[model samples]
Target: MRIVIAEDAVLLRAGLVRLLTEAGHEVVADVDTAEGLLKAVEQHEPDFALVDVRLPPTFTDEGIRAAVLVRSQHPRIAVLVLSQYVEERYAAELIASRRDGLGYLLKDRVADVDQFLESVGTVGAGGTVLDPEVVSQLLVRSRHRQDLELLSPREHEVLGLMAQGLSNASIAANLFLTESSVEKHIRSVFTKLGLAHEDGGNRRVRAVLRYLGYPDPGPGHPSSAHPSHQEFRP
Candidate 1:
């Protein structure tokens, strides 16, 4: 795979370059500033970009802004953003881009090299990948919302795993349930959240996250209005 890295810290940038290089992936461009990162993406058009959520020249949300721009402009290039904190707002914005090939992970997760690489691969392959910590924080922050309150305990478990980018098969394995059972739970989650079951891929995930109060800032995205709540008959 080809990758472009956008990180301001010298040592960490060097480490990422070495790691990706050693993993048999080519690092097409290594840049320090958000502007430079955008330029590199335009020039290289790498398969994936590893971006830090904060960048030089104010360091607030340059990286995230650049990531969203990439999704809007390039669309084909996958992005995995690294953040020092689990900023739910930033995560929501990135997901609001409503693109598949996106990931948000805490910088601390880099220590687990294997899992980090797995996340990279997953994003590169056009899948959404959210850090477990990010998912946990979002769950806690939105637990009081009525949409979330509508879910059963098991459905809540499945929704959390789904937000972590787990497929039905993986969620089933983790929950010690059959894949069919996991699918049923996921359907129940969508129905309770007032999201259409036919809305597969990232749209469904975004709807669920929006219902969780992350608030998709995407243009024309639906507001958090629930369909008439129906009892879970199973």
Candidate 2:
């Protein structure tokens, strides 16, 4: 895949560039600021962009805003943002606006080079991927928590695996279920979540996002930090 990387930390940026390049993916542009990210996207029109959630100047939501802009402007450019924390509202906002070819992963996930590359490929191929921590944190703030309560414990587990971009086979293996059983549980999740009309891979992602609170952020919702967010990050 051809890619652009926007990260403020010099060493991390360099490491990413080296890693992607060594893995035989093109690094079209590597920049440190959110504005630079936009400029790079407009210039290169790379297949995907790996961005940090925070970038130069304010270091708060810059990369995310730029990512949203890129998605709006060039709908074809896949974007996967790496974050230092499990940013709750912005993550949901980004996903709610455009779920396809999008992802939010904690930086530590990058340490698992093979899996990180797989995530890059997944998002670039127009799939959604969220780090497990992001899903867990987002669930705590779910505006539809009661809706989530409608799921059976098994269905809940299935949807959680779905949120992590796991396939039915993978989810089955993880949960020690047969693939057919996994599919049944997934369908139940969709029906209970009222995503029956959502359809195909889209519904699965939609259901996972909905169950995990990736909808429009409610104004009444607290903007305070979620306790789970603090527990996971290094």
Candidate 3:
């Protein structure tokens, strides 16, 4: 797969290039600044990009903004972000857009080279991969809802898979269940969460997003389980 990398750190940037290059994948462009990163993306049009959360000019969310811009302008480009910390707000911004092919992970995940490559491949294939840490944080924030507390452990596992943006088949494969059973579990989950919506094509994704308090607020859009009038703080 062809890739563009946007990271501020010199060592990590070089290491990622070496790793991808050694693994037989092409690293089309590796740049330090967010502007240069976007330029490289525009010029080379790589299949996927691995971006860091922080970059030059302002070491605060410059790369994140660029990634969002890429997703908006080039809907086809898969983008994975590696950040020092998992911010629910950032995840909400990414998921708010209707398109897929997105990932947000903690920086430490880089230590597991093989697994990291696997995630890169998954997102590049139009899948969404969220860090388990991010998932946990979202869940904790959503726990105030009595409906969420009612989910059985197995059903909760299904919800997590849904949040990762996996389809029924993929979730079934991951959970070692038949696709039919996964569908059944999903139906039950929607019922339990009181999130039944025929218009929302991907109810599972919407459910997970709502459960995480990032509803779309449209016909099929997610409604706030937690209202927008409320402010969530760290």
Candidate 4:
């Protein structure tokens, strides 16, 4: 897939370029600053962009701001953020009622190369991919939310995995439950949360956003089939 990368760390940026290049995907551009990333994406119009939370100059929210801008200006380009810190506020803003082709993975939490590649593919293919730590942090902050409190423990597990952008089958494998059981739990979540949308993917995104305190962007955008939770062991 065509791609652009934005990270200030030279070694890490080079490693990402080399890693992705060797894996047979083309790296159209790799830049050190958020401006460079935006320019590269606009110039190459890559299928997706892999960004860091921080970037040059300020080393603070530059990369994320660029990411949000890319989404706004070029809705077709998917985004995956890799950050050393959680940056909960930026995460929520980036999510902003959209889940597909979006990801937020903690840099230190990316334990395996293969898993990282899996997540890359997930976001590239328009699937959601949140780091489990990101999911936990987002959820913990919303535990007192009324809609969230309606979930059963099993439903909550399913909800978290769903927020992580796992397919029903993947969630089943992770939880050691049957796929049917996973579907049932997901259905219950929708019922309890009042997200009775016609599209399954829409409902999934809505549930995730509801817990995160964002509303669905609109109706009818299809959700992508999720990849396995590869960053950690089941």
Candidate 5:
């Protein structure tokens, strides 16, 4: 895959470039600042962009903001954010626009070279990949929400895997169940969450994440009304 990297740290930036290069992926452009990252994306139009959540100047959320801009302007270019800390808000915002072709991984994950490369390839192919830490954080926040209470213990397990962008096959393997059984659990999850089951696209992904409050409701998109605890049938 052709890639663009945005990292403020010199050693980390060089390491990423070397890693990708050795892995046979082309590093089309590498930049240290968020502004430069945006310009590099606009110029190279790489298939994937590996960004850090913190960048130069403020060093708060510049990389994330630039990533959002890339998604808005270059929808086809996938973004994978590598951060030192698992900031739930940043993860939520990154996945808010669309679930597919997005990733948020903690910096420590890079040590697992094989898995890290796999994640990059997955996101490059229009898949979602969230750090296990991020998934845990989102799950904790959602657990107290009224809608999430509708899920059974098993269903909650399935939902957590779903939020990790795992396919039914993967969730089935991890949970020691048949793929069909996983599908059934997913359907039940969608029903309990009041999300429509569509024949195609990432509807399930969107539903699970949105229910966890990842998708910020923009203008004209009112927030979903959480059903009363008594109203939950599941």
Candidate 6:
């Protein structure tokens, strides 16, 4: 697939190009600024694009803003956003577009090359890919919502770790429980949240995002160092 990358960090940009190329996908274009990145997409019409959450000028939401614009102008092109830290507000804005070929993952996740590649392929195939951390953030903020208030503490813990992008094994390790127990907690959380039963996949992300009041940003805005609610980020 032809992919465009928009990231301000030169080293990481080059590293991504090299990695994707080695994995046999074409890196059609790479740019450091959101404007240049958007222009490249307009020119190249790549199959998908990887955008950073922050870019030039404000260094805040420029890249994300660009992605939103792209979604409006080019619905067929997929986008996967990378961020040092994700905000529920930003996630809401992106998802609000109603575009399916989207992803929002933390930058640290890039270190897991295989998983990163899988995410790339996933979006390229028109699937949504959300970082578990983003999912966790959504769930925490939603707890205040009347529908989610009844979750047991154990179920809440499972949901939080799941949002952190932990596998059942990892969740089990963190909670000092068996993998089967972890699965049980997940099922309980799912049922309590009134989510449909399926393979789950990115639906979990979407449900949690809606629950957290993403586009609205809930109560107050907090820096990455401090989140308004603890359940969302842990």
Residue-wise C-alpha lDDT for candidate 6, range 1-234, written one tens digit per residue: 999999999999999999999999999999999999889988999988899989998898999999999888999989999999867778878988965899999999999999999999998899999999988876666653655577787877776676665778888999999999987876776676666565344334543543444432322223222334433322
Runs off by more than 4 Å, candidate 6: 145-234
True lDDT of residue 217, candidate 4? 44
TM-score of each: 0.62, 0.63, 0.61, 0.62, 0.63, 0.63
What overall lDDT, based on C-alpha atoms, would model 5 receive against the true structure? 0.82
Per-residue CA lDDT of model 5 for 1-234, tens digit only, reads: 999999989998999999999999999999999999988987998999999999989999999999999999999999999999988888878888888899999999999999999999999999999999999877755653667789889999988887666778889999999999998988887777666544233445445555555642322232323322212112
Record all residue pairs in model 1 with backbone atoms less than 3 Å apart, i.e. clashing.
none
- When superposed on Cα atoms, how far off is each prediction in RMSD? 15.8, 15.8, 15.5, 16.1, 15.8, 14.3
Tens-digit lDDT string for candidate 3 (24-131): 889999999889988999999999999998898979878888999989999999999899988777766776774479999999998999999899888989999999
* lDDT scores of the candidates, listed in order: 0.82, 0.83, 0.81, 0.82, 0.82, 0.79
lDDT order, best first, reads 2, 4, 5, 1, 3, 6
- Candidate 2 per-residue lDDT, tens place, 126-230, comes to 999999988976775674677788999999998888767678898999999999999899888878767645254456555655665655222222321222322
Q: lDDT per residue, candidate 1, 22-77, as tens digits?
A: 99899999999999998998898899999999999999999999999998999889
Which 10 successive residues of model 4 have the least lDDT summed?
224-233
Candidate achieving higher lDDT, 3 or 4: 4
The ten-residue window of minimal lDDT in model 1 covers 225-234
Count of residue pairs whose backbone atoms collide, per candidate: 0, 0, 1, 0, 0, 3
Model 4 C-alpha lDDT per residue in residues 1-234, reported as the tens digit of each score: 999999889998898998888888999999999999988987999998999999989898999999999998998889999999788789988998478899999997455789999999989999999988778767755653777888999998888887776788899999999999998998888888776656555667667766555434444643222323222222
Q: Per the 3 Å backbone cut-off, how many clashing residue pairs does candidate 4 have?
A: 0
Q: Candidate 4 local accuracy as lDDT?
A: 0.82
* Residue pairs whose backbone atoms clash in candidate 6: 132-163, 133-163, 137-232
